[model samples]
Target: MDIGFASSYLRSLFLTSLFSFVAPLLLMGSTIAGLSIISYVPWLGRLSQPGFELVWAFLRTFGNGNALEGSLVIGSTCGLVGALFDTYIFYRQNTFRR
Candidate 1:
């Protein structure tokens, strides 16, 4: 109930939400960017590399094998999973401290 406790709690919550949103979007964007860039810049493929290949393979197997579909699938799945994981970690930290 004290200011110190409230501030700390809010900080943790903010971090959890921020991380859940940012990390997945970054991953999804990067994956799509990697896929997009391969045609234009072949030599710089090192940046995305095998990770892009793996994701592309997944898209080919499960989805329509297009960039838009891949982006949607990757974004949604990564966001959901990342949110769950971040929430779990946040909950565990709060509970274990008590």
Candidate 2:
């Protein structure tokens, strides 16, 4: 086994994990901010109330329980899967070339 190859792969895997984890949190934060802004829009607020309630409930359940841990686990799993897929594709391409 090549140490350099292994290290490079691990580095990519870590970056993938970090990106997946951060992207969702950023999206969630932006969503919350947008919703908060919308909540003050009078007519729009009334229209969005039920949807907001549902979202709030969902967040309360997941966000309060184990959101951070869950996100980490999910992100790592995704990264691993992506890395595996990439490795498979690379091998396939090399095999074809050889």
- After best superposition, candidate 2 residue 78: deviation in angstroms? 5.4
**Model 2, residue 96: what's the lDDT?**
100
Per-model TM values vs. the true structure: 0.48, 0.62
Specify the highest-TM-score model's number.
2
What is candidate 1's lDDT per residue for 60-80, written digit by digit as tens? 654576755665666566656
Task: Give the per-residue lDDT of model 2 (tens digit) for 55-84.
Answer: 556655654565555445554665567667
Q: What count of clashes does model 1 give?
A: 0
**lDDT of the structure predicted as candidate 2:** 0.66
- On the 0 to 100 scale, the lDDT of residue 59 in model 2 is 55
What shift in Å separates residue 55 of candidate 2 from its native position after superposition?
Answer: 1.5
- Identify the candidate with maximal lDDT: 1
65 Cα displacement, candidate 1 (Å)? 15
Candidate 1 lDDT trough over 10 residues, lowest sum: 67-76
| Model 2 alpha-carbon miss at residue 79, Å | 5.9
